[model samples]
Target: MGHDQVVTSKGNDHPGNGPAVSREEFDALFEALRTWGRWTPADRGACNRVSPEHVRRAADLVRSGTVVPLARPWDTEPGPDNARPALHYMSELGDAEAPEPSVHKDFLGADYHGKAVSHLDALSHIAYRGRLYDGRTAREAVGSRGARFGAVSALGPLVTRGVLLDLPAVSGEKWLEPGRAVHAPDLVAAEEALGVTFGEGDAVLLRTGRLRRRRERGAWDLDAASAGLHVHAMPLLAERGICVLGGDGDSDVRPSPVDGVRSPVHTLALAAMGVPLLDNLALEALSAACAEAGRYAFLLVVAPLNVPGGTGSPVTPVAVL
Candidate 1:
């Protein structure tokens, strides 16, 4: 089917056996990767990404409600390290003397006139050069008419391996200190200690375990948000061929382990490289699940809004055994 075709029902590709991707589909993906000119060096790095068939299978399970999706709670006053928009909704609208329609609204509603936070970043969210992964420019992707890819809506559906790194557990500390950069060594050590190696297409989740403390202290300052990947760490992850990098911290990169730089991770990973980074994820549940399973690897699924050319969206991601 063409990209424009809406996959109305779940499991449309593999009707019976859930969405387990077939080897044939994997081969097709390889073919596309080899032939597609828009594919970047970073995209080439992601060529080993978990097969689409894998994603389909996970989505099938998610649709069945067999996989419990942990809802991401909005952190109204997330500390300095982590800060983003909080979704809200309103059930009632106009005043007693006002017009008939009562305003029932979501903080960012999903109606024609309203806006809702999207869950995924479309390929257009960050382009390598002047164009997107599919060779389309940001200007071509956006317009007064409506939003498209590169917007929150273009990323069709994201699915792959999701891995979590509990930094505090690895460091034997209560929390990774704010402005303290997380290095590649820390990640490697954590992986060794946890006995998990992030695969090429894995969606890596980093848990600083600081956000919980921040919430407990009721301080939403930017400085309190810990758990960020340092600038040097970006290349490490890129070399590993990781598709997505997420954390409970403010950004994926800090200036250095000692220097305090903000949003460096966004610039290096999202801007410099084409790797999409997920921020402010509620990874407590995910961490628990991985620990319970005694395994850090699992099927991950995330579907971005198909808004033609949007930026980022709130992703509804899930982990399955």
Candidate 2:
């Protein structure tokens, strides 16, 4: 169905099956993964892990020259999760009385910091305990003008090896049900099953088959419940030295396993590890492409808009196999 045509119902909360994490436990994990002051003063955050050598190596993975675009369509209708659907309307239409030449124009806008749009979250996007990555106070770094420290402009263009951890494919399931928590063990199992391993400078994308589930079962409140990584999985990702983390959902399993926190993974990845996140990606086509090619790793490139002082940018990342 067209994006605007999908009807949605109140989303059920997916209180994942993982053990509850106390505020203290969550704080400990945050401290353990924190990369504050690790790199030079910069807005790229963990993206600095990707170097020229990494990009060269990633380019070597493109053997079949297959390209997959990992962006959901610009949703123009609101749903339980998409409170602000993208706007698409004609701005100008050709008028016979105007002149001999005719042209058509349209406009587009979105409050993309939601579940419907595919977007990248800059380090400035998340703040924990009143501070951002690199120990910048949120109030001091971000203001009405935008972010001064972690703007998307500092993260120029991202080029690295992309790893697709297809959980459903590994488990012989079509999709992991909402409220399902993917822990460290799941990552290890998926790596073994897919014959792929995580490494530094890699963009790890976890596909829980969210879109497929919605297509088959109809729309529900995604904010209330979604299949994603638990806070327990952050250590593995940090150990692997990933620069980018993305998924069909926002990368956090909900209702958050961490007590008193809404998006623990977001906090861990962005505020603690300084890793940027690609949220709300449409990874179904990438999964099919990987399966057809018999490989899960690819050369991934993402170029966010150079919006100075902006928190993040809407992006259409591309993966080549």
Candidate 3:
């Protein structure tokens, strides 16, 4: 779909999903947004935009010195949202053989790419037309071990200014209802409402109040319906030169605006734009902090586990102000 075919926000009575698009149209979009061969290390993708100066500027935003973590509790319970719940079990329950001193131990693991765990997605995590971010062949780049090109280890320790686009605050709704598509207009309206603007190397976070909804109501199938960016919003974000993009719903509106694409935003940001993604972040506390501070931007830090060749990592990102 083109700019003319853009879908408005939930308030517009749009069909939730926008116009039906052919594979050719989606390919046109993919080609238009690509940033291949722009940087020396292709795996770092748009993360290269964040320089040391950006980090210093971000740290300057820490006025109150209050910190808020963005990851939800590591979910071990089965729910409608988490099909494969993360594993947490005691390896030793205060019964180590070290004299009278006992030790407590546990193991943690998860297929964190799903709707449950808050995680950061590297460029190799998504492929379009059999290729990764720099058009490297996915089959060859991703071996039996993990991604050879865009490993999570490559994009290490992202620190940048973060902007929270809290749509519910602008709409006066608890959350954008499931299956709603957030558009460029919605982002602009949010920027206007929150007194923040997208800037170079910024970590743009879209908060649809998914956690608040789940806290009040219950878990619904995100595959069926979820509020997130539509493909039409990519051009604006790309022009702003975002270093990272994230959201509560993996950054794609469900029943995708484009036909035959389940996660168009992922394809656009990761495969096309080479921008890493943070999925399933719990932004309620961050939202409240921003509102309390009367500002939406803050110093955001993402330190993913240094997993070599891993496509992504479970992360506990934090916002400070």
Put down candidate 1 lDDT per residue, 226-283, tens digits, no spaces. 3466554655786777777776654542222222223445534544445565655666
Off by over 4 Å in 3: 1-14
Task: Please write out the lDDT profile of model 3 over residues 1-321, one tens digit for every residue.
Answer: 111122334322346665556778889989999999998788999999999999999999999999999998999988778999999999998855677678888999999999999999999999987999988999999999998999999999999999999999999999988777788988999999999998999999999999888877777778767888888889999999999999877998876767667688999999999999999999999989999999999999999999999999999999999
Estimate the Cα RMSD of every predicted model relative to the unseen true structure. Answer: 14.4, 3.1, 5.4
User: Candidate 1: minimum summed lDDT over ten consecutive residues — where?
Assistant: 1-10
Q: By lDDT, is 1 or 2 better?
A: 2
Q: Write the per-residue lDDT of candidate 2 for residues 204-318, one digit (tens) a residue.
A: 9999998998887766676677789989999999999999999999999876787788899999998889999999999999999999999999999999999999889999999
Error of 2 at 274 (Å): 0.5
TM-score of each: 0.66, 0.95, 0.94
Where in model 2 is the C-alpha error above 4 Å? 1-16
The model with the greater lDDT, 1 or 3, is: 3
